[model samples]
Target: MKNYQLKRLSDQPILQTSDVKPSIDGFDVLGAFNPGACIVNNEVILLLRVAEAPGARPGFVKVPLLEEQNGVPTLIIKEFPEPEEDFDPRVVTIEGKAYLTSLSHLRLARSKDGIHFTVDEKPFLFPARMDESYGIEDARITFLDGKYWITYTAVSEHGPGVGLAVTTDFLDVERIGMILPPPNKDVALFPEKINGKYVLFHRPMVSDIGRPSIWLAESIDGEHWGNNRYLFGGRGANNPRFAWEGGKIGGGPEPMLTDEGWLLCYHGADETHAYSLALALLDKTDPTSILDRSDLPLLSPELPWEREGFFPNVVFSNGWVRWPEGSDKAGQIWVYYGAADDGVGLAELVQS
Candidate 1:
């Protein structure tokens, strides 16, 4: 029923959660979904992923820490009670320590017509240092050789790693820290520079040392990575055949090379975390191989803002915006997802 050409763009929420004052102190700014899209001079750029809280609920847990005190930037808040209701509910352990109900950073959006985005009042990238002190999340922007090379998702308290930053004019940015550490993340790279080296795609869950899937690394010098393999995972854990892609599968946005080879727009989830949107096709010069995919979904989560907010049906993405740039046999891609994580959805694949 949908082979791609699903356009929703924006009914609301291009970016939210910003009263400016964030150094802690009451908090309140709770959404702004994942982004990391790009285009640069032609416009359409989004690095968005802003989440803040104070009254963040849903089984409880809110921890945000980032300090500088007298030098300025500061944010600290940690609260966890009620024995730590596990069994999902977005995790909130207590004595053993665990957090994350909200608090993220990196905000900046602009669009010429990638679908009307224009966010930028504050937050260029927050949570500075101490391993990102519990904030900073899912970015994945890679332009390579010329400049633009983000790769976010830092989160502190010693978990969820994979951070690196660089910008030519996203207004001076250059963090570049943990390449792929604690639990890894959907780190992405590979815009150019493949056959010679530097090609990444991370997702390392390390539950006991396995099952979280999606790997493939190689770097001549894009920040000291190693040579990990894997690729895409999910056939167990939750992909009971494809219970909507079974619960875990990542590596979305930032892959697109095209000529019918490196498209790769992924993001699946099932087992109730319900997020969808798929597309795969690699092997430009051996992008770890893989040929074609999208056995069913090219997008899902049926409207209603992708089925209600704060993570309902989900539909996450890291970025998109393709056009007359090397012609993938067609033109106009535009993607940019993140609906039901609450806001940010724009479709348009169009490849004839």
Candidate 2:
């Protein structure tokens, strides 16, 4: 078996310490940033997971906003009061109940270079309705048929599901509603339609029936998805310590098509929640057929920054850029991932 190793591309964090607020007034914390990557127009865009704490009151939760307070730049937090236990810290509760500890919203940032980024003043995406009252996280972008398709996680008291959104430009997005609901997420759309239908990679969590594993689905119109099947599951064989990736494996970035097969870069997490990057190959025509997979991780939590934070021992990627054909690094892949849930990290794949 050929050993696959992830070469660190950037030592410094790419997207770190976001300043976010809810509405015009709210208390803001250094929000967690992840799942950011390069897009069209040579602009590097980021989908930031903004976290805000409530106000100092019994039932009031604070939402943070960026503004000038008495002549200096300050974060303004808005307070909202609800019944006791309305905002649960552990799980999501809705309609006179508690919900996820922190409300997550998707904020945008743009950059000329993949490193330094400028956050947009407004949030690019939010939980407008009940199904997504819990918030959205982990956005994967794919440009297909002239439009960009974004697949993200929709959280609510019910459970975690997959949501879809489409946009030609980042300015405005069309919400396609929840495509895959309840107990599913980590969706990545194939670059192009297969056999006149769209193909997507997803992971469905089943604690009793099965473990959290990657799956595949097909759709005619990007909105409606069906025909689901399992792609892969937990690590085994001569693979790395099973405990390191025992919980689940998820699709990451867009799969790279090569003469060998579809090269998929994915992340696996263990019981401890430590994450590492691994690779797999799928049939070009039928992605469900596994051709080869790196038993061990291509990248893991080795860097100091990637080994500690909100969640320690994690390196998660959602986006990457592939060089055009004919170049020296034609098939080289650049991945942008989160480090220990604290900040962003970068890595590059040199195709052999």
Candidate 3:
């Protein structure tokens, strides 16, 4: 029952809301976090989930969304009267409809050392389709089939679902539409085909009978996914030893193949909604079989920045990349994570 430890690369968050500029005129960048990291042509590229919203007015709650008018996509702000019901600062409920205080879109941030990044002024991928009317978020990048396959969450009136996009070069992208439907998110593809099929890990949210947990799915074309199998963290299927994730758990970064097995980094939340990172190892031949997992969290909200922000006591990640060949830290894994939902931080995964 050994614990996995991680080394914090820096004392402070690498990127914050203030470092990003808003895509829309009236909106301001609220947060920049949960970026998908990969190396393209020797540079570390991060597809950042940039959350933005309009400033609050006197008596109205503001919600920002992407709307279509005359076949053109437009960013619009919707206002609702303050409600009597209990509401979260990030989400407001008005007459049975839920609206987000801010909308999220993916933007590009490039880095030479994988620490300091220069963010693009404009959004690299935004809500253009009907399913993404709310916005896109938490992109997970996997380079497979000679292209970068981005699996992300698309939010709309329907709820959060998994969407796919492909790119050979970061400058251009092609949307493959929504693959997994509503109540599902935290999707990440395995870097290579397994058992002659594309394998992926996703979290299908549960409300009534079960808990939100990780699931495995298979695909032939990488666009259509099926053969769902429950992996961990649901009711009755007890994983009590991993009680830190007693509330819910989900897949994080793309799994990296190792000599022992496939190394997985996932996030979990407890009853208090405190988020932390954990590790697991799955059989290389049959990923459905879990070999070993972290009994305790690998990384948690320890620093002030990680303990406070838009969402407090949260340290979530969807991205990690091995320090490239020839670099001083070549063998170590660099994890890019969202700190308290407001800023980006870096950590080195030390498997002891």
Best candidate, TM-score: 3
lDDT of 3 by residue, 128-193 (tens): 888898889999999999999999999998899999999999999999999999989999999999
lDDT of 1 by residue, 1-352 (tens): 2344445555554554442334345676666777888887677788878777776666546666675678765777666654533344445666777777567888887867566667776888887777777788879788889898898879777788888989898998988788888878888898888779988888877665555668888988899988888877765464455777766788876787866678777787877878887777888998778876765667788867678877788878878867655544236777777778656777777653
After superposing candidate 2 on the true structure, give the runs of residues whose Cα lies further than 4 Å from its correct spot: 1-4, 18-24, 55-98, 236-241, 324-331
Q: Relative to the unseen true structure, what is the C-alpha lDDT of residue 178 in candidate 2, on a scale of 0 to 100?
A: 92
Tell me the TM-score of each prediction against the true structure: 0.32, 0.84, 0.96
TM-score of 3: 0.96
lDDT of 2 by residue, 135-171 (tens): 7788888889998888888876678898888888888
Scanning candidate 2 in windows of ten residues, the lowest lDDT window is 86-95
What TM-score does structure 2 among the candidates reach? 0.84
Which candidate would rank higher by TM-score, 1 or 3? 3
Candidate order (TM-score): 3, 2, 1
Rate residue 212 of model 3 by lDDT.
89
